[model samples]
Target: MSRLGSFAGDKMKTRGRKVRGSAYLAVPFVLLAFVATASTAFAATESTSKTAIFARVTWKVVKPGDAVDFDLQITNGARLGEDPVTYDLKILDLPEGWQEKFFYQGEQVKSLTLKPGESLTVTVEILTAPNSSTGIYQLTFMAYSWMAEYASTQSLSVELREPIREINLVATFPGIVAQVGETVQHSIVIQNRGESGESLRLSALAPEGWSTRFITQDKSEVSSVYLAAGQSITLALETETTDNATPGGYTLTVRASSEDGVVNALMELMIALREKENVSDFDFVSRFPEVTAEAGKSLTYPITLRNLSANDQEIILSVVTAPEKWKTAFKSGDTEVTRITLNPSQSLDLIFQATPPSEVSVGDYSIVVEAESGSTVKQVVFKAKVVGLYKLDVQPSTLYTSVTAGNPLTTTVKVTNSGLSPVTTLSIQVTAPSGWDVSFSPARALSLDPKDSYSFTVTVVPPSNTVAGDYLISVKALSDQYVSDEVQLRVTVEAPTSWALAGVVVAVIAVSLLIFIFKKFSRR
Candidate 1:
């Protein structure tokens, strides 16, 4: 070789040698490329990469309280075969107040054997600093190895929480007997049920037509006083039912969430409205025949009392003032039907034997009955008199009651109210002997007046197959006001099988004719 050309050959050989820095730079890139290839081993690269970063980490976070969690991640980034390999962190990428305790596995990694898809887990604390920011932050992470600089880093995110103040409010309101729409001024027993004294916060939710205010023992401003656990404060909630407010029950919920993650709870308020007495359904039963009485005697009205509200109610049951010269005996049905005291949705019947004023005719008299239940009262009015004349005169002057089985024994029941007043809503029924069916034909609603008589058909049917025998028939009549005394239904049922003899004779004739024909034919 020429002397100069020999020198150039030496230079070219020297230039061809790989620089240590170039090797360093290629490390991360190779590692990254390997990882990329392994990730998509079957995938082709869309473009070539000039640089890459990779991470070797198993990131984790810890829970400090019920409200928060902390996490950390660690990774390394290096240039391929580079000297003094180092990394830089961007503050803008991290949370404003979050403390990023950068954990570096190493400044430089010198491994070429790393194939694609290889990774290691390391710890890097992304902790909430004492002075952590109040908003979300994103941090980028990258890692690298010798052969190639592995690329990529996950973005870590965090939520920053603001310091809050603790508040506890409690109240003890008094029981009240309020009329409908009545205003209740209530004082509540309040307490700071929390830890660490604080500038206690006090507030009220929507209270109906009500106002709230705190009353400190020392009259401290409710806004600024530091309240410790077990400490107490008083507040008043004033509200009144509207003039048109519905009478019933209501609830109010007041809450307290503690600052500094202290204790939290709430108070509940229950309000009730009292109502006036009103009448609902009212009915009556008589104490005469079957609930019977003499023609000259008076009847008792058994009235029932009922409560229809959710609250326990007390009702005052009473009879109105009696007219001069009147006689009556009254008793509560408690001893008769039910012995237990009645509660809500409960009722009791009372029987009153009210006689017409001495000079009053033996007729229905308007009697007023009143019941007072708690703050509720009701009055009911009904009429009663000398029970019907019951001199039920059967038409034709006699109840000729003879009925064959399968026949209707119709008789005119002239129920005359010989007494003075009109009888309304008469429900009549006729009873019969066992095995004998009885019914009132032309079934209907009926009403009768003083000395007035009603005519209705009473029907009795004896079974068509009734055996020859005598059966006593009976009848009963019930009205809204009275039940008639059971009347004797003198009925005789005869053996109605007389047609059996006729059927037998016909059968005998038919047999003889058949026999005669057979004999004649044989002879021929």
Candidate 2:
């Protein structure tokens, strides 16, 4: 019995040893797996911390059928000298029928590479469907780096709304003068101030028996025009007046309408008509009956003379009435003439010159000119208005000055109003050589009466390194109405006193040394 018990005990001991051996072998595998998991987790954390994604605007409000762009930057915050990492880009949770694309440097891209401590910019363009409903849509953009095993995501939202539609119509000249059997032309501008392009039909409503048409600058007639957003076009409206049209005022309506008639613009124009003058044996006309001239100046008027008589006739021209001390003359091709002969149905061009006195007051004067041929007589009235002249004269106290380098030189300048009117808002300006400084004591003046003058103190400083030479400086007086002639001043730059003294000392030393050398050699 003892022997049998011993055998059983030995078998139990063997089984216990095998169990312990199996446990010891499994402990190494478990520890190795734990260490591997910890290392992997550390690597993932390190990589994620070194990468980032950023977007300036993550939310925006947009209109239906509009494209939205989100600018994003992918940054690798890892230490420099590390290898570049390539990131794969993707869009998540995008609605169906909506298109998405990524662009880098204007080219479509699916992936981008960024060096350590460097960043790359990319654009995510999202195009919404034309018929998209008004609501808020959210989209996610993700970037994954295969080398670093890291990922970053950015969320963006867009609120779609209805678009605004608008149109503008403008008339350059809303009033026009026309004679019977004459075609009157008017200019109109159309603009589309909307978020999309549109097709607009142009039409005009005129009085009965009048024809109207819309034509472009190239003379091409167009019933409809296409205008893009913020686009403008100029069109001409031509209207024909009837031969027997009564003398009255009429209103014409101009309109521009979109394709759907939802957007429209309207403008009203006024047309005035008068009776045509009867035919006569002689005709005299002046295009400009009134003219504005400056005091102490001469003005000329162009006149047309036609002889409708059946025979050759001699016409006499003369000024019947004019302002006292004012001179008037009629010239044909630079030759003074008092009478001219013209054949039947012949025309002659004449120039009428009028000069106002220097001391003429500011007012309007009427002058009557007459032309007579046998029994037929024609007269024209001209109005001339004299306006005040604006002139400025800039004078300096001294035209020339001398200055040493690195020193300031001050001079007085006078500004005079040599005009017939007062000068206001006057200021003085000084232009000097480069690296020089200039300043004025009183920078601006409120007003200067006629023949009055104002004095200004100008200080100029030259740079320390300026070479000894001559430089030109200019000063001028300016006002809101006119600018005076530039007054030039010559500035002579000389060496500093210390430098001159030093040069003298050097010369004396050299002369003394030469004398000593000569005496010593003579004695030898």
Candidate 3:
């Protein structure tokens, strides 16, 4: 530490003369010169903790003095992506009062500060007392501190492992059915499936006549032990039902424990059991939903396309509609609903919104939405009505005409309310092409009685130098505040010519000549 302070003091004295630049340039210079900044920031983190961490530990009651070790990791929270410092590590699991000792390079470390951005990880040794009891046991790793941040963290865990004397118990009952007053026998198979021999032992759930026995049946049953790894032996279970034995199901658990933990085998006994249930194949077809809607109303429904095959069948479905006026939109979860494929026994549900146009006549319209699955076609029908009790019929479905420039042209428009119904908010508007002035008499609205006829004059004034020839003019007649007809017109304007006055001069000359001739004849 003193050496570092001396080096810093010397550099500070010598560097004081080099600080002549303006302070405004300091931030820019630092921002532009960032090559060593991140490295300097990372070097300030320190890890003060035991190099070896215990991620998981376990103790077994059967082995009384054994423990298991698993792999774990250590980290310096401040600096990541760097190698963790390593040292030999050992864990001690004791029966409450045993002493523990750990060595690193033959020296007992009181507390090793894993250097800046380093972690000491241990995986080589597993320490246990000559006597350790287990159901399960855990060891907490010592806390690690980051000195600069004043933050410390510790992790503790427990893991169940197969001890060196690991044993596996597998038992099975005979036949699928068992009943009272019947001698039902079952066998318990014991195997040392671990890396070491297990000390064997046995116990029975039912005593007396209903009992358990090794093949060499003895009360002190498991007296002969030391079953080697991967070795197997079978024990027998005999039960004689009494007159009062209930008819039901029961479970027998055969357990084998080691210095590590307990492993068990379950034997299920079924009493008064019937035959197993048989399930048929999935051969059901899906039905399309029907829709009924009122006039000027919209209804939405789902069409389910299902796959009823046993094997995965690529079923494709396509949709078609019979009504052009009805607005139909289909959306699947993601993409547009054009064609879809389904897996076996899977169904795709599509929501379809059907909106009926309000302008259709008030008669029942037959609409059909057909879904064509591969090799199968199904139809879903919808009844739509215009509710065409009564409707007003206009002579021209659309108004389209031409008018001279600067002329007010009047045309009779016919409106026939053929329906038993009368509509409101009727208005008329006449529009001309851009750059042409247009207006209509009673420009805002017209109240026409049923089967009414009215003539409205539309004055279209062509601007000076207005392009002569064809231009589109729109005349819109609205019903219920909606545009019902848009009529287009072709208007042509003749270019103003200079010859219009020449004929006046010729007429005047003829008349003057006649007068002069008459005077001369009269004088003679």
Arrange candidates by lDDT, descending. 2, 1, 3
lDDT per residue (tens digit) for residues 21-86 in model 3:
264356446433432432332233213322223344322222434444444444444355543432
Give the lDDT of residue 203 in candidate 2: 95
In candidate 2, stretches whose alpha carbon ends up further than 4 angstroms from where it belongs are: 1-49, 57-67, 129-134, 147-150, 158-162, 171-187, 215-222, 234-238, 259-262, 272-304, 307-316, 319-337, 340-344, 349-524
Error of 3 at 18 (Å): 67
Query: What are the per-residue Cα lDDT tens digits for candidate 1 across 446-506?
Result: 7666666667777677878876566765555555666667666567765444656787899
TM-score-sorted candidate list, best first: 2, 1, 3
- Give the higher-TM-score candidate: 2 or 3: 2
Of the two candidates 1 and 2, the one with more favorable TM-score, higher being better, is: 2
Best by TM-score: 2
Top model by lDDT, which number? Answer: 2
Question: How far is 390's C-alpha from truth in model 2 (Å)?
Answer: 25
**lDDT minimum window of 10 residues, candidate 2:** 11-20
TM-score per candidate, chains pooled: 0.29, 0.49, 0.29
Q: Write the per-residue lDDT of candidate 2 for residues 132-232, one digit (tens) a residue.
A: 76766656666766544455666677777766678998887899988777799999999999877889999999999999999999999999999998999
